[model samples]
Target chain A: MDLAPYLLLAGLEGLVQASVLMLTALGLSLVFGVMRVVNVAHGEFYMLGALIAWACGAYIPGPPVLGFVAGLLVAPLAVGALAWAADRAVLQKIGYNPEGTIVSTIGMLYILQQGALLTFGPDARAVDAPFYYTIRTPWFGYSSYKLFTVAVAILLVAGLWLLMRKSKVGLLMRATQFDRETALNFGIPVGKVYSAVFAIGAMMAAVAGVLVVPNQQAHYLMGTDPLLLSFVVVIVGGLGSIPGTIAAAVLIGLSDGLLSVFFSPTLAKIVSTLLVALVLIFRPEGLFTVKGRRA
Target chain B: MTKLQVEGLSAFYGQSQALRGLTLELSGGEVLCLLGRNGAGKTTALKAIMGTVPPSSGRLVLDGRELTGLPPQEIPRAGIGYVPQGRRLFTELTVWENLEIGLMTRKTGREALEHALELFPVLRERMQQRSGTLSGGEQTMLAMARAMCLNPSVIMLDEPTEGLMPSAIAGIREAVIRLRSEGVAILLVEQRVDAVLPVADRVAFMDHGEIKAELPIAEVRANPDLLHHYVGIAARPARPATC
Candidate 1:
């Protein structure tokens, strides 16, 4: 058995896992950082995206590429709209109280999960990737679609970075995150900004879902793992810190992939959980967070 | 002409009232100072005008435009700038970003920023630094500069010189005088009467949420006993007037 080849495979697999985890965890961190709401239903939005992609792939009368394209376009927008409606109709009405939003999102999680079960049925489904090609490496062959997923994730993350750093909307969101009352007094419509942030966060998760659905089975309960992993990532990374979330996602994702391949998936889970515990004990603020002014 | 008018304004915090039928007016290019003890509703009056505190009964008009009951976000758009207490600078943001937020409701470009920087040159020097790292005086200057970026017809400042060295206080006083000269109405709420009085065109003494006396600075200067009775301190010899 060539251990080098196995390690290389694990590394590639870890990259894929890290890519998906980055999108999901970034969304979670953004929502928590700005709205200060623990969106218990964030996973449901991911599940919804996957299910939506499945439906688009199955029903859209076209080639696999067309269906995949439709799913890519429609899933995120639909989920984003749904999240915005939730913010306006439920979260905003509750004044976005931290404890209240937690409860409300828990209720949303159940509702979304059950809604999928009732409408989409309990069976798991998969969507075909738009293109099927392999890139043969020295050790083995890898799916081109998987590499595409990595590329798309990198592009989207870069775009998000620019949006946060350069755009006026990003400035308003940062201002609102720092001090809601002061932002309001400055004539920034903070309520609208909250809705936009909530929508964008859900959209990021949905895009991740759309990207990963071709490889994984889209089930009503598929959001469970992503949600749990994202929570671990954000906690280990530090809440509300973007760069920290990305760094932590890569660390956790690579470890999970490498460990699961070398040992067992259950062991990987235990290790990650223990790692989180250690991080909380030692550096509760996360690994990559800056020491300056508290956000 | 008066740029802002507060008629019969009242505000309450849950069960207790903070402002009781407070009425005041600020003219264009004139600086009006409100002097009062702590808990005397001086801050509440400013908050009510800014729409941070919901007015129970009042009418706020800015240049003949009705402003009462408008949302806090809309108040800035209606041509009023506010520098709230504690210099609420977005601590994590850079000084430039903080100033950008001040232009949230206004349509101004780099020229507006340049004007603000001219007023507080230290902010220009520390444009890239996080606002939290600024000294107390610099933070106050940044807060004032941020408000000025709105290009507002009227600006309300609450304790702009609180906890500052004499030099920083002088800077704020100079800025106030300059803004007045630029034809911007100024509504100032301050406890530092000695530092603010020289810049004020008129002073209104507030006690128990009501204005006990309103008079020009010259009239208030003439009656030292009135200053002693209302402010608990005799009016100091008037400083050589400027602005």
Candidate 2:
């Protein structure tokens, strides 16, 4: 058996999955890098986006593209507003206890998940991929929609890199990550930076949700898998290294894609779990570390 | 003209009051050294002025503008640059990045960057090195350089010469002297009396929270007893005013 077509398909799926994970993980990395807050409820923000898409489809008559785009744009703003409220209400009050934050966000996650289930029911919901038909590639004999996903992922990553690395706000972000008090001394409004970062992080999660639903589909429970996988990606990448997170996401995707082809999909899951554990065990500081903590 | 003034500034750590009714006045082109031993609340005084530790009841006037309960970042924008203790130069960031963070307030041109690098020629060579890897002298230099980037009218340094070699301390002393020559009002808080007082124009000693004594640098040099009493130093305050 040539097995080339199947591998290509698997690679396409893996790339798309990696793309979604990388975007969300980038947000997590930035937040953790600066604020040291491990937001466990971040997955809920993605779920909220999916819910927003579904609601848009149900209530308003529009193309699936419009609905998905609505979710991408609207959900983050909504979640960001929620996050701002949450930051001022909770995170600010507690004064940044890592364990406490983890507990609070996990609690938030449960609330969002259950709330969605109660509103939408426990059953999974299907999202019509904005691009409905597969683009026939005579040479590869695989759907080019997968290729489209790859292109979008590349663009998203590029945009994020430029924003974090080149722009003035990007310098502030890095400065914030580098040293909070120094940045403050340099006349940086830290509270504003926090809110902006949290919103952007929330937005990335929402975009991840939109990307996933088109191909993999979304449900109240949909965020659960990505949330778990992103956690794995973050741990493997290091707690706060953007480049490390991207590399780890791709590694995970490739592993899943290849393992799925050779072994059962169940085995693929087992291998991915093992990979996560192995990374944590070996590189306890994650792939990148500056002075024991994530930089 | 007074560049910065703190009136009846009392600060606290939780419930314990660190500073009580502390008032300080510094004019532009002046070097005012706050001299004290540990626990004298010199650090707290700097913190209060910079708005890091909110004064429980007081007002800080920077350039005739009140900085009451203002945030730390805003205080700097009001024309005060602070170099906190331990040279808090984001250990992971490179020297250039540390410099970049300092210039975040202003739109710094290449000239300013070149000026900063020239001011501390060592920083030019060490720009790529992470701050943590820098020697204590380099860190102190970078900290001063970072503060310099804000183009501040007034700068406050908290024990910047702590745990440094004589040469490093001398380098900082020269920098402070140069800063004053450039007309940047400076508040140099130091535990080491002789190390800083030589270059200072005026000196204020703090025993508990409030200023115990305020005298010109020449007056301070005359009273070695004052230095011994407050700072617990046995050294005769040097009479180096002839230089």
The weakest ten consecutive residues by lDDT in model 2 chain B span B234-243
Residue A129's lDDT within candidate 2 is 68
TM-scores, each model vs. reference:
0.95, 0.89
Name the runs in model 2 displaced over 4 angstroms. Answer: A2-9, A56-63, A118-121, A132-141, A288-295, B94-96, B106-118, B121-135, B236-243
Q: Candidate 1's residue-wise lDDT over A29-58, tens digit each?
A: 999988898998998889999999999999
Worst 10 residues of 2 chain A by lDDT: A286-295
Error of 1 at B95 (Å): 2.6
Q: DockQ of every model listed?
A: 0.76, 0.63
For A1-295, candidate 2 gives per-residue lDDT tens digits of: 3677777767776777788888778777777877888988888878877777666655556777777667666776787788777777777777678888888888888888898889988877777766656666544555555666667767888887898877878778777887777678888888778777877787788867766666665688777777778888888888878878888889887877777777777887788788778877887777655435443
Top candidate, metric DockQ: 1
Q: What is the lDDT for A205 in model 1?
A: 94
